[model samples]
Target: MFTNYHEAIEWIHSRLAFGVKPGLERMKWLMNRLGNPEQSIKAVHVAGTNGKGSTIAFTRSVLQEAGYSVGTFTSPFILTFNERISVNGAPIEDEEWLSLVNEIKPFVDELDQTELGAATEFEIITACAFAYFAHVHQVDFVLLETGLGGRLDSTNIAVPILTAITSIGHDHMAILGDTLEQIAAEKAGIIKEGIPMITAVHQPEALAVIQNTAKEKNAECISLHDTCSFDEQQPTETGERFTLRTSKRQYPQLETGLIGTHQRQNASLAVLLIEWLEQEGYISVTEEQIYEGIRQAVWAGRFEKVKDHPPVYLDGAHNEEGIDRLIETVQAHFFSKKVHICFSALKDKPYKKMIQKLEAVSSSIHFVSFDFPRAESAEKLYVCSHLDAKSYDDDPRTVLEFIQKKSDDPSAVILVTGSLYFISDIRNRMIG
Candidate 1:
């Protein structure tokens, strides 16, 4: 048994070497051994390529505003590992994490000897989250964000009361498939029989897949494209403001702390889900609660302004679609300022295409690779850029210092983008 948090965390992370095996058999066995803790909790299964975390943040904040304690399970945490399983935005205490790891470590060891083999790192973490929410401390609702493609993801073990697909895009293509249709099929796999779904997917191929899946499951799928109508939508200095009209209600001047136009779509998904919950008699939440919740919702590392003077922002736009959104956000907010970019990405991503997009908006681009197995090297990312005003560095700190020196101009704005892992590292150094 692990006696300390450090040992417990180390053991949990050690399972990473086993790599990802996409199947539910191991998760089913683990859950069964743990008394099926997932079955005891009311969950909302969320799947998508990019906006899942933002959607969950908006939803959780709204639920909390209505006086409900919400548990959220998300991946690739922007802050700490403990943020993966948090209650009302607070990471579970160290003592709670230790207890959870102790309770599940035996099953993890036992599973290693079985036909299904040892569970992956994500599976163990998913189990810990389920056990904590169900057996240790219950909450009004648990939001489960799939770590990868939905169908085979470990978080799929939970039978959620509601499900949402934030958006379908090209991400995790190696495991999920290359085409939008194939990716959509994997994402739509979260749709359960008779469980209503909500989505913000606009792509025809992707939307069709989700619609067909919902129809096959005999579930009503609510598409934001069909249900939501925006009026007077405009970007704000801090975030955004818009009048959102859904089939059921009209929210005047809805505001959010999250940046970009895509965030508006994300916030809309949360509003729709919360409205659906209230309409279905599962929860009671006033409209005011939702508005306040949205206004208060903030997800770190998504165009987050860490410093005011000589403004410096961080955005985790690792993929092409994410980079597009990041570009739009930068254009919308800092069009007048000279934008200097610090970028890094995973080796497997289409950094060439993403860097191409960022090049259009950047005054100068600096590339630096961080310490991750899959991370692309600074030289490789730098070579991908066609910009004459670009530089490369092996150490991110050196690149950061160089960018800080350039940020002396009052008209210059510094942006750190690309991989979330890289952003997490930079955020700790800059803020913590």
Candidate 2:
């Protein structure tokens, strides 16, 4: 087994490959060579442009509350790599992660030798999660979230009991597709034959595409809007208290640890999925456990409050829809306070539209570039945002300093947003 976290992560990162390699030939080969660990357990596959993580969080929590040992695998870790693999709602320990990586490295290497090439960063991570859940933790169920568009994503390997698509939006246009209908088609690829597919409320065009795809695949499709509704009241210092009402169940006074109105919809979808699972006899969780799970569950780096004094808010609003939600939440909660913003985004993102949204809410904007190859230059961001603001160095710390100086008002809120990578960087700095 690997001796340390650094070695394990480095070994995985050493085999990074870019771009889409459509078809599951490579993933199927790799998993088979590793004894097909993914098949040993049941899974719930989630895909979407937005809110997939939150849906996963809710699904996992509900299963865990049902007294089943659940394993959750999601991408783009906010603070630590260990966050990608969790069992029973706790991140896998560093020692366990290293050991798991060591166990899976040989199979990954063998795949490389046979001309499949080493798995992508996301592919390797997905493999690790499956092996950990199936072989190590021996989980009763595993919740998997797609890394990107689902049609060709590495995580699409599983034949899940239920497939879910959260709210669809226009992000990753270059890699997925340019139009909403095309993107919806790609996201809808997770619908396997006869598998019950659950979806959040989607645009008519997107919904039509998804419905057609599910019909073509012979998958039973469940729409969240048709099954569930929510009532979000004003936010308090503790957080937002919302009521989740489904056709068969009602969770009144449901308070989420997560912020924003969008989360209310996410929670409703989670409840609906759990209800569906229970009906199918896949799992059985009590109403009390459901309430507990919603109250205690936490998904970091999405509308998370990092500081109280001089109020700092961190959200990974990397796309137009996400930015809109961030703006709405900020306006509702901190409308009187001037907003100081720190922003960055991947080159492939709709940076121009994202910038426009931020410009509408931001009192001052500071741009910074992350170390990733996909990150856009700070100068480009500043120009595209069309804000006459002073530029800071590419360094995240330097940008944070600028925000600190500008946000002198105790009531003023400093919002660190625009990209998940940027939030990851800030999270690293804060902990260090």
Candidate 3:
């Protein structure tokens, strides 16, 4: 058994060699061995190509504001692994993490001895989240965000009270399928029989897929546009404020720490989910509580400004859609400011297209590579980008220094974008 947090993390990472196996069979067995912890806790299962994390953050904050004990499980840790699982905004303590890992290690070993096969790294982490929520934290509601495509993601095993799809787009296309319809079908797999679903997908093909899936499962699917429409988004000193017009309500000047127009849609979805919960008599939360929750919710690494002087910001725009949103927000807010970009991306991403979008707006672009196995090196990206005058550095910190040095004007803005893994490393070095 692992005796400490470091050992636990080491053991978990050791299973990475097994890679991703997209199926719920192993997870089902693990949960059963752990007394079906997932069935014991109330949960809101969330999935989508983007905005799932922000939506979960908004819902979790609102629930907390309503005096409900909330547990959250998310992925691609922007800061630390502990942030991936939290209760009331505080991450799992080291002692709690070690204790839980020790308790579950034996069960995992027993699974290894059988024909069912050992759990993947994500599955083990997911099992730990279930055990923590159901047995340790005993939360009133748990926000479970799928680690990958909803159909076979590790977190899809939860028996949630409701499910939400933030937005459908092209991401993980290889695993989820190449076409929009195919990806939408994979995402729609989270809809459970008789459960309610909410989605922000407006794309016709994607919406039709989700509708059909929910219909087949006898789930009540509610599109955000059918219930509410967002408008009047204006960036503020802290974040942004927007208005939501629902069928039965008008939420004006809703504020949130998460920026970008897409955030308004996400926050609106959270509002709709809460109202649906109230209608079903599952949870009672006041409108005022929700307003405060959306305002107070802090989703780091999504266009987050971690520094003021010289104006350094970090965003997780790993995919094309995310990059588009990031670009729109940057243009809307920082157009007057001289923008210098420090970015990196995974080798698998359409970096050429993303870099082109950034280059159109930035005064200069600097690419930096982190330690992620699939990360595209800055040197290779520089030659491939064909940016005749842009800078390249293997070390992210040096890239940051270069951007700061180049942008010396008072209105200069130093921005960081690219893979979430790269952003995680940059955030740790710059802020931690």
Task: Locate the minimum summed-lDDT window of 10 residues in model 3.
Answer: 399-408
Candidate 1: segments with Cα more than 4 A from true spot:
none
In model 3, the Cα lDDT at residue 123 comes to 91
User: For model 1, how big is the CA root-mean-square deviation?
Assistant: 0.8
Best by lDDT: 1
Model 3 steric clash pairs: none
- Please identify model 2 stretches exceeding 4 Å from their true place: 1-4, 17-20, 406-408
* Candidate 3, residue 383: lDDT: 72
lDDT digits (tens) for residues 62-88 of candidate 2: 677668888888888887778889888
lDDT tens readout by residue for model 1, 209-299: 9999999999999999988899998899889999999999999999998988899999999999999999988899988999999999989
**TM per model?**
0.99, 0.94, 0.97
What global local distance difference test value does model 2 have?
Answer: 0.82
What TM-score does candidate 2 get on C-alpha atoms? 0.94
